[model samples]
Target: MSNSGMAIRPVLWDGDVFRVLDQRLLPHKEHYIDCDTSDKAIRAIKNMAVRGAPAVGLTGAAAVALGAREIDARDVDTFMKKFDRLCDRVKRARPTGYNLEWAVEQMRLVVVENLSIGIDAIVEKLREKSEALINEDIEVNRAIGAWGKDVIPAEGAVLTYCNAGGLATGGYGTALGVIRAAWEEGKKFHVFACETRPYLQGSRLTMFELLKEGIPATLITDNAAGFLMQKKKINVVVVGADRITANGDVANKIGTYSLAVLAKTHNIPFYVAAPRSTIDPMKSRGDQIPIEERPGREITHLGGKAIAPAGTEALYLAFDVTPSRYVSGIITEVGIITRPYTRNIRLALQKEAGK
Candidate 1:
């Protein structure tokens, strides 16, 4: 019940200014970016200053509120037009994460429903809604942790990719939340954090969170996951999702699919922990989801220094999809949805909606 050890808050809004922990400078620098305008907020998301699905979404909601406050509309019709454009811009800031669009839509709904209240009231409501999202995300993540803690073995190694921790969400995390919950419940287990290449979020952010929480963890190269799995060092795989399709295909950091494959081959339970908002009902399968290709410089350089030849060409696909069949279970705040994901995912989402 006490998250005293998990003292990281990646996103924060204090009425007027939107602030985000610049994740790009993590482990080395703990800098926070003050986004006073919507453009600044969107830039933070694009530059990876504020990242991870849930964090991005929470920031997007705040960005909408910031934009709404700046709009000089006198009437409902004028406000609605400007608000629509603002939401579209925020949604396009990052195409891969469903949470961004979801959060924007949530703010948009508040605007639509409050049309009778005038522009000033709507702007105030937007601010309130954004703050509410921050609280809701933390609560949802805790619920996910509660449901997923049982999946973690009492004494073993749990493999996780990327930086799904307090750094990845409003407060607590999705996948890391499960591990944290298990740890809090007195489960003895070690964590194998993949040093996700190009970005190194696991090495920088995940390691930072684990150490801060006093959880036992080891850092490993992304490629070393299979070697450890083969040796039976890993008991389970739990990672966060950027987007999940209706059929239960998961889109996460680029190397997630590989880890899922390795976990499946090793006969380890591969779990995807995420909030219900991460699920995209619009996409029936993984292939239908749009994959965001990042700048090639991300692949060609490290720490602002070129690691390859001047003319070297590289591809940077930010994310990859893991088919539902490889997943042992899809962990959500509602519960763990197992095989026959199409049916179970639908049922689980409906259950969440009812709540």
Candidate 2:
């Protein structure tokens, strides 16, 4: 989890400035954007400079702290009003990723609890809390890795979608974290990185990370997944989630649902690795989870070259929901949640609260 080694982190807090690695230009360019204001942080999230559910959540917390440092309010009442507005703005940055709202609420609690002390003290507390969120993200991902690693076969193949590596989160990762943990545990396995279209996070970012770590991985077209599964080349399917409803339905990259369905047909165990913050206990079902529609250009073109005729309308849903029935289990930092997910998810969350 520490970058002191060879790992590169997507998010970092350098003194008062928060830095995020720009993922849009990966596998060719490595760029870091320093966000000194809440507006800058919000823009980074919106523009995809910082992505993945956990990474954005951590960024949201940092954004709140950065906003707090600039607050000019002298009274606690005015400070609360302004802070609440700031939290609302961050929360509205993205709808699919529950982690953003969860992180914002976490940061809000810090401000509310310390408001009686004064704005300066409250800002200081926010700073500490934000930093803790970042550090805790790394720890949480590592814990997820520890728990999910056991699910990996001793020697087989694992199929993963998108770029759920350190580049996707605050430090280690989620699905890729489990992969890394399993590899570190001396489990020999091959990784299939699906070339997730539109964004191509897997082909670009995931491949970059695997190659950097010298992990054995193959780049496959998104549609080739079913063939591989049919051939029994895939042992398990693991992906990270943007949000998980109370019933355990998963919301992830647009192609994730297809992968889950194929895995189900192939009788392969499909797993979702994420931090507890990714779960939305309030949402009873997947249909209630908001789906973000991205620009049509993303689906109509590739690398600035049009794949379709100009003005050809395209649907660009950023994510899709996979029913809990297709999921074999939900991997979290705490542990894996099996069926009867509604009950197990609540029990797991309760245990996390007690901790």
Winner by TM-score: 1
Q: How far is candidate 2 from the true structure (C-alpha RMSD, Å)?
A: 1.7
- Can you give the lDDT of residue 105 in candidate 2? 98
Q: In candidate 2, what are the lDDT values of residues 1-355, reduced to their tens digit? A: 3332227778888888988888887878888899999999999999888889999998999899999888788799998999999999999898899999999999999987887798899998998998898888888888888899998999999999998888878778899999998988889999999999888999998888888777899999999999999999999999999999999999999999999999999899999999889999999999999999988988899878999998999999999999999999999987899989999999889775224
List ranges where model 2 is wrong by over 4 Å: 1-6, 353-355
Q: Show the colliding residue pairs in model 2.
A: none
Specify the poorest-scoring 10-residue window by lDDT in model 1: 1-10
lDDT of 1 by residue, 44-106 (tens): 999999889999999999989999998988788988998899999999999998999999999
Off by over 4 Å in 1: 1-5, 352-355
Best by lDDT: 1
